[model samples]
Target: MKRNKFWLLGTLILTVTFILSACGNQNSSNSSNKQVLTVATSAEMATLSTTKYSDTTSLEALQNTFEGLYRFNSQNKPVLAGASKVSISSNKKVYTFTLRKNARWSNGDPVTAKDYVFAWRKMVDPTAASPNSQRFESIKNGVAIASGKMASTKLGIKALGTYKLQITLESPISYFSELMTGAPFYPQDEKIVKKYGNQYGTTAKKTVFNGPFVVTNWNGTNLKWNYVKNKKYWDKKAIKLQKVNVQVIKDASTAANLYKTNKLDYAMLTTDYIKQYQKTSGFHSKTIPLIGYMSFNTHRKTTANIHFRKAIAMAFNKESLVKNVLHTGSTLNGIVPKNFAYNTTTGDDYRKDAGNMLTYNLKEAKKQWAEARKELGKRKISIELLTSDTTDSKQIGEYLQSQLETNLPGLSVSLRSIPLKSRLAATTDYDFDIVYGTWQPDYADPVNFISDGGQYHLDDDYNNRNFRNLLNEAATKYATNPTKRWSTLIKAEKQLIKTDAFTAPVYQGGTAYLLKNKVKGLQLSPYGTVLFYRNVSIK
Candidate 1:
């Protein structure tokens, strides 16, 4: 009986050992399958449609999962991505591109020339209700077609064959290639959209990717996306990192804690904490063009007063505001920020007249406030300063409230801290007297600064329409004749600055993010883009 019991025990031991060995192998396989990388930004990815919504968080996230025909390399210039070859006609009006033939979507559908043509056409289609469809107007006949003047067939793009794309434009744009490097020109698979109906791309699952990674998961607003390297990608063989993991980390303090615990690979710092991490062990900063401002409701009864407008502009000192609020030296002098590469051919200067315009002149500001007070019928100029209750916004508002009342006698300012979404809605609906805002450059050109900074009406959302109209006119003139356009845009920009004071140009900021040590060859453009995924890899 004792011998029989020993034999049974031996058998049980062997069984347990086998099970443990198998579990170990399974874990090893899963680990080998992934090369995870996470990025923690300040906000949630607002939308997956980068082309339709130009929101910063959306663009940053979509730039990774979706790709364009061309991508900017580490040198801050555009290089061919899916395109096999590129050529421009002698007149510089026509461009020809040959797409790589073997590329396929995440679902294995063959990506063809017509797929690109369909996507581009939809961008300019008026019925599409695209906010950024205005970008495609650069192509020949593109504006008229986008404006509903002609059928999209008249627009200048043609699929020469299954792998060829031809584009014609009205002007010789030196930045055309760079413009195509972003979502404004990224291709969308038409087959997936046709299959899904109105539900297409509403969630991460509904979307398809032709780029190096595809989003594998999302739960409505809470995104848990993972990227699996695309086997159908043209240069997929060169890809070293097989996977990417991104979790939504919205709070800056929480992100810092994650980094300290080694739970995060990369994270963004709050303005309050930037100084401490400026040169710390994991710190990495890159400066890109980012402009900040506070816009007023030009249509409001009190806000419509030109002197009232000018009072706000002169009330806040840009330098002190940046130093006090942002704690950075990025305070801006005028509307057109410094260091944005100037294209001189437009004859006259297009840069914002920062010198003579509103600078940090407290005495002058007090004088202007008195004049504005009289102009406003000595009504003790009081209005709501609409802004989100964000830590930065609230802090800035407190400072501004104190400064404005001290500088402008009889200026009674009421601080309103609304939710971020509410602030945005109110600004869109023209329900706010003054609100905090910023303008990000769409392209490298000066036109980006002048088109009311492209803060035009966003889909029936009420805005300073008259100011936007003036900006549009200036943009058109700049496109046709830059020199003349510069003069006109400057005049328009100044009209807001010197006249109605549509904005208090606070400070022009820049982009800065941390990168993991294991990640290699990650590059960001001066215009705020991460490009050339082909070379990015994990060590």
Candidate 2:
């Protein structure tokens, strides 16, 4: 799974517009009326294409507008959506799915099994340069196809007929069903994609929808758009709201004013407004399984030294960063957040099992810094820290700079605050000394955080053969042994954090927001699309 970065820049508000002039009957009952829900987000939608999007906001938009083989229910369990039936082979490596006959796109085209094959193949095609290509590495020939060693046509997905889909995996993934609920696994309309070519998914009119809603008024760069109900959806009757208007609001005060004036039904509160609204009836907070950490550019000589990385990690205090700077999250001891993954046998939280691998020790940090200086034969070292230009991120970056410089002698730290897109691009290009990033789980599994050859390892150029072998053993060797796989994953995490010190664990993410009492049925999950609006209704 790709690592997701969280930004606490601004507020997103959902405004409910009541249509009183439609009819007298509509005025009598709020539940029976057609309403327009106007919502605000901190950032604009990057893309609607399932194969290319990488942000949480884009995932939420895609989740509301597209249906996959399966969908997560309110309880965060996988439920059937596009596929009506499924069967697993005796070896559990092959999966056969039966597409719903009534499933139709917003353009009135029948959604067939061919759509799945085309989408999966296109995602793994090296030419596409998809950030999510690694998610399909479990499929047969997926690694080879992604690395350009083989043609995309050799991918292990096949459309048996118009409505039958067959997918062959190299190994049995325990969370394969939950993985299907992600947008990356959702099918794409090949005809629409070909017709639009390079312009596909750039705008609302350029794409087709198979879910309960279709996006509108988005011109690829605009900050406002709408999600209109898709009448052609197979289960359209279950959808309540007819239209949902979305906007990007970058100010917390503006969101507060909108909420106070009844212009907004739901608004995400920043730390500045959390205390002010905590006593209010609409205040809501959710602790998600998102962990913030700093990735070292191992390619750089200074950061490549394990002593230097350890010095930086131990110099700063995560407790102070979370309690004072962020004011919403909890301190993290490892890459995986607390209350996230549990031991399969003992049901113990992974954090409890891993113990405290990260700590604050000024003395040990000084010792590590001296060793690093001796190894590199340098009296002074300067490094740049990269972070998003969001209010919270800038604050965190500033705090880190102060803490490191104050704790370590002969150390100079510089902060580079860039927009989220630019920061992501820079991180991908390995253009910084140390970059602060976050990772949210795609599924409720430790492998999602510490997978072998996954985002965590590949992005930072941290190639510990033993670490990779441990993760590989857990996935393949102990494929059916739950206890063994659990122990192996714990070892891999230790190797990454304690042994190599490739990255520094910062804090876990927490979302604080306000929702009107009238809004109902909005489902929030810790993994995969944080927000679900399919069953949402505004009373």
Candidate 3:
């Protein structure tokens, strides 16, 4: 009886052991099935519709699901996608493209020429209210129609067939190709747009992917997300990763912790942490296309005078700010930096032409302030500075407040910090004395810096004060002449600096994220747009 009992016990133990081994194998297989790159980005999406996008966070999310007619290469120059050939007419008025029939959306729908036509028209349509419509003015009549002078259909884009598209333009634009590879021109399927009317792209499930990944279970505020591979994507073989997960974290310290714990694959270092982490393992940094500056409310009674603007611009010791507030990159003297921001005509660089004394000109600034005080009644004026709650923003605001007061005796400045969205609204409404503003270029072009709402000519052109009507008029001349445009842009930038009208502040550059060594194929250009994340992978 004892021997039989022992034999039964041994048989039961072996059976249980086999079952547990099978479960372990199953879990490993599931994990190995997909390679996911987890990204930590704030989950603020502007809008699902590519045209109406205003927020950077949301646009980055949408870029994963939709396919543009042209997509940016690692260098940010446009490359043909669904299109087989893209060419401009000799006169530069006609742009033609032949589509590749092999392209398919994630839902197995054909990506056709009509899709491109519909998307382009939808963007510039006055009713479309697309923020990016201004980016496409080089397309035939695109400028006039977008300005509301011409009819929506009058804008120069049309589909000749299921796979061919031609864009007519009033003039030539140097950065047109770069614009094509980005958002405002991305094609939307008529079938999908029609199926989900106003609700389309409002949720994660309503959209389809023609790019490398599909966003699943996305919420506007999720610190986490998934970017699943699109098997139907035209270049699926080049996409090795099966998924990408995005996690939002506001604190750089927390981000570092995540990277250390193996919870994050990549992380950005704040100025406070840059020095400490540069000595630790896995540290990296690079420059990006962001420009951070303080926009003084020229509309304010006390601040309205141009001298006040010049004084404020002069107060910024860019070199000191870079050393104290920003530790990661070089201090840029001009608003636009070198190796970036070009002129269309001679391709004269805005940064190179910008005279180099990156250091502050106290004497020049002081004289401007004196002139400003004489223009105004007050030897002393109390002004307010506004900022957001981020660690970087608050510090910058506090620093500015201190600098202005210390440098200029008559300047009494107060500081206030609010949420980012509210601060943006305040700046737009001219609600404060001075507010910090940042601009990320829509496309790589000289017009990007000088144009309003992405277009050059508007009766009210709210984005710019139309600082130089001469420059604006000159830009119009270059509307067809690229060389002439470059010279005019240079002249405008020079005049802008000479007057101390505005400071570019900090040329926020690329981020050197500490990415997990195993991660691969996550590509970015020096001037990267967050919206082009289709081909990124983990392995």
Candidate 4:
């Protein structure tokens, strides 16, 4: 009897030991399967809240974790992602989308049409204070709700069922579908959002993701963050990377050094390092639709004079600035960037159609300065220039100050390099004489930019009712007529650039980067400079 009892005890112990050994092996295998891609960005993500933030840094992070009804693919073309099917009305003022039934949040909650409704309403809520709410002004009652004239519930989006969503528009916008691919239009989980209140999206554990990856290891203000593949994503099979590690290295030299040590898979190149790596194997140079320009505060005494603005615009050498200083990007001939918009009739680029309106003529600038001085009844003028504190921005600001002071007699430019958010606030508060600003296109349409309610409109004090009227007519009367709309917008571009000189178009921005050869399938889209990493893989 004693021997039998001992044998049974030994068998049970062996079985338990075998189970524990199998579990340990499984965990080791899982750890080995985790593949991480490490990269570098210039700045930390300002905010993860979709509606409150409108910068590319935030958008890049959000797009990887929270998908919209539509998404730009690896080729930068609009493709359906969250939505399975979409139908549009004949008048083009209404749209209906059918969501993917299998899509679920990282918390295992089903993503429904009601989530979209909640997000859209929150975006335009009067109390929300969302800076990006204006992007949805084309939706029915969107402008009214944002302006506090209508209730948030009255905004033009509704859910017909668990998966069907309907939207009404005030007018037929050609780029409406493309606009839906952006981060601002992504859905938010109402219950989760409300549960967290002000703490939502402030930490990795506080937010829920439904896209390809879920943010992890973020402390809301850390220099580093991680993206872990979400197993619950409906299209998880297509996501090749198991993890992505991003480090914020604001200095270009530091980023290059990290790349050299194989610590980074990608690094952005500034003028200082472009020459050294121009012939490197992984180096690439591409121009996007980012436009860098100078905004003059028309309310200021010296800048209020139209001739003075024109003199400042023509005095600077754009070509030299592009080649000698920037070492990247092309000189801008007009406000709208090159290869940004197209002519529906001839299929030519809008910049090519408009031709070059900005000129670099010292003689003409001197003549205009003389007229400006006579008009102001002052021999000397001083203006303060506000710009971001980034290395490239500081370099450009110092160069501008030197050139403007040397080329234009009796004119002095004082440059102030502030943080990005602070610079934006200063522009909104009208606190500076001039501010160096860069704008990325929201969509393909020219009307989307260079129209009323833009930064130039707020800053430029020039009384150009004719130009404003032209823009309004194009936006409304010619909204559906592609040819006429393009023509009218072209006229507006010429007037703004040539006749009024509302803002000086400096250059079309470009990004030069060093990417590892193994990294494949990352794309930079035309709309809003959105980056798509859905197909990116390290092999």
Residues 1-539 of candidate 3 have per-residue lDDT tens digits of 00000000010000000000011111234334345455665323424677645545555666666667677676656787768898888977688888878888889999998888888887777666555666665677776676678887776778888788888765666666776766677888889888988767766677776787787876543445677878888888766666566655545667667667666665666656665677767776666655555555545666656677767776767767767765655665555555667654456666676555324667877887888888786688888887655566666678778888989888898888765445544544557777654445656665555443111112232234345554555535667666666667666655554443544354344454565655545555335435345554333
C-alpha TM-score for every candidate: 0.80, 0.90, 0.82, 0.86
In candidate 4 the C-alpha lDDT for residue 32 amounts to: 33
Model 1 C-alpha lDDT per residue in residues 1-539, reported as the tens digit of each score: 00000000010000000000011111233333234444443333445654454445455456666666787666767788878788989977799998887778878887777877887887788777565666775688776777688888877889899888898887766678777876767777887888875676667787888887766675446645555677767667666655565554434556666666665555555466566567767675544456666666666667766666666777776667766556553766566676674646733333433344666677777777667777667657778876555455566678778887887777788899754434554654677787765555656765555443534342232245565665566545345565665566666666556555555676666443444576666655455433334466544
lDDT of 4 by residue, 1-539 (tens): 00000000010000000000011111233233335566566555556677655445566779899998998776677889999999999999889999999999999999999999999999888687665666676788886787688999998999999999999988788788788987779999989999999888877888899999998888777878888889999999888767777766556777677667766566667766776778877888878777777877777888877799889888888888889877888998677888878887789988887788877888988999999999999899988988766677777788788889999989988889875545655665678887776666667877655652134433124446776676657756887777887878888877877887878877777777777765667666664344556787654
Q: Estimate the lDDT of model 1.
A: 0.60
Rank order by lDDT, top first? 2, 4, 1, 3
Candidate 3, overall lDDT?
Answer: 0.60
Model 3 regions lying over 4 Å from their true place? 1-33, 74-77, 106-109, 126-129, 190-201, 221-223, 341-349, 356-359, 370-380, 410-416, 419-422, 425-432, 452-483, 495-504, 508-510, 529-535
lDDT comparison, 1 vs 4, better candidate: 4
- Alpha-carbon runs more than 4 Å astray in model 4: 1-34, 125-129, 144-149, 196-199, 202-206, 374-377, 452-468, 527-530
Clashes of each: 2, 0, 16, 0
Error of 1 at 232 (Å): 3.0
Q: Tell how far residue 194 is off in model 4, in angstroms.
A: 3.4
**Model 1 TM-score, 2 decimals:** 0.80
Top candidate (lDDT): 2
> Global CA lDDT of candidate 2, please?
0.76
In order of TM-score, best first, we have 2, 4, 3, 1
The weakest ten consecutive residues by lDDT in model 2 span: 8-17
